[model samples]
Target: MNSERDALTEILAWRRHGDPNISAVEAPVVKMVVFAVGDTLFAFPGASVTEILPMTTIYWVPGCPSSLEGVINVRGDVTSVIRLGDLLGVEHVTEDGRTAILLGHGNAMCSGLRVDRVLDVLDVLEERIQPPLSTLPERFQPWATGMFAYQGRSVLALDLGRLFQDYRAGLA
Candidate 1:
């Protein structure tokens, strides 16, 4: 029974002193959902995205803001749809095989952002993200928080809160 007790003590000692080779310091990562508006790639913080839905018929609401595409009936809940491409000054291409990214929740500024396609969800390291490029158009620069190189492609990280604020202010 002494041998068994010694083995248990050794196991406890190993557990207390974990492998020294494995560094505990990890770079901070930002979780985001990357999507395409045209050829341009944009990323939204993952927490802001509620759901992604396939393209559906959008009923136009007369007298609404030009940026707003229309309303969509999502599971019996009528959600307003925003033509993100239009707001971004991107050409209004035909909405073939588009996707809607539902944003916000109850009592928040809930709406759906229509995009050409959903690219991916990524955990990008914080250090890799740089400030929004000055070369971007003035209208688009304010909404873009940062930019990062992902898989050889430069992805712009959007600030949804600022975008929505500007949208409501009739800037978009």
Candidate 2:
């Protein structure tokens, strides 16, 4: 009984301070919110997503790019809504997109990405992500950071920073 007690104490001490011999290398993981746009599944890092809102009334902005669906009043803050399908060159399967994922990229540059549906949050190992598939349109390659399989489907991870930058450049 004393031997077992001693072993327990040793285990507790080891837990408090991890073993030095064990390589500390840990797999990189990112929390992402996966959503559907058209028939394709896409993901954005959770840190970039400020909020998820239901479809709301959007005030149209004349002369805005086709990708810009309109402006929405989010808690008195008017934010531009981007039609992700238009940007991805995919036909929106849903006539009325059901959700908007509010995304932010520093300096208060934020917008709501209209999506067909809001899926779930997933913790994805960075190594599991593969390069964008060759079959994807060339234009989409730049925005696709990587791809990974989730629940038997391929989810393309988007680089929100680059995407927003591209959008801003297009305005120039």
Candidate 3:
């Protein structure tokens, strides 16, 4: 089996049209970096992300869910940021050290999810995706639309709409 680095290299090459064997028949699989909240891996689609910035000042909103880290002013837009780990019921996103992903969720819903770090961006065929795992908790299961194998790793494809809905409901 190829090492993770090797797989990434090959995938990158394939994306750059370096390999003739792999033909992207459909709209090229969008690239994304998969991150972890404990053992669970979550993907942030590259297209939705506006920027990944180092931890910055966040105004805390009292009475908010523990998953909510705080609100940030990103590029003049005040965006509500949620700790990716906390929302998943995993580790707490550290305030002093972490990465904040500014995501643009269309229609002015959820603006972004703060994560620990970006793992890697890989191209995954949409056709190869399978429905979310049946073993996941029923309530949280809908947050992920499906999973796809990328560079020998299973990358969860998050449904932004479902995540937005869940978070919005949590606020109410």
If both were scored by TM-score, which would come out higher, candidate 2 or candidate 3? 2
TM-score to true structure, per model? 0.80, 0.78, 0.71
Ranking by lDDT: 2, 1, 3
User: Over all chains combined, what TM-score does candidate 1 have?
Assistant: 0.80
Task: Tell me, by TM-score, which candidate is best.
Answer: 1
Model 3 clashing residue pairs (backbone): none
lDDT of 3 at 26: 55
Model 1 per-residue lDDT tens digits across residues 1-118: 4556586687787789865767677889989888887788888888778888888889999999877989988889998889888888886455566655555432257788888888
lDDT by residue (66-156, candidate 2, tens digit) is 7898888888888888988888887776755565555556334788888888889889988898988889878689889889998999999
Over 4 Å off in model 1, which ranges?
1-21, 92-95, 102-107
Winner by lDDT between candidate 2 and candidate 1: 2
**lDDT, residue 44, candidate 1:** 86
Predicted candidate 3 versus true structure: per-residue lDDT over 1-172, tens digit per residue: 8456787787898777757965645565666667655555677676656666667788899997767767888778798887776666667444345454646473357566777766666676666778888886664566677787756777677766567776677631
lDDT, residue 119, model 1: 80
Cα distance off (Å), candidate 1, residue 104 = 4.7
Candidate 2 runs further than 4 Å off: 1-26, 95-97, 106-108
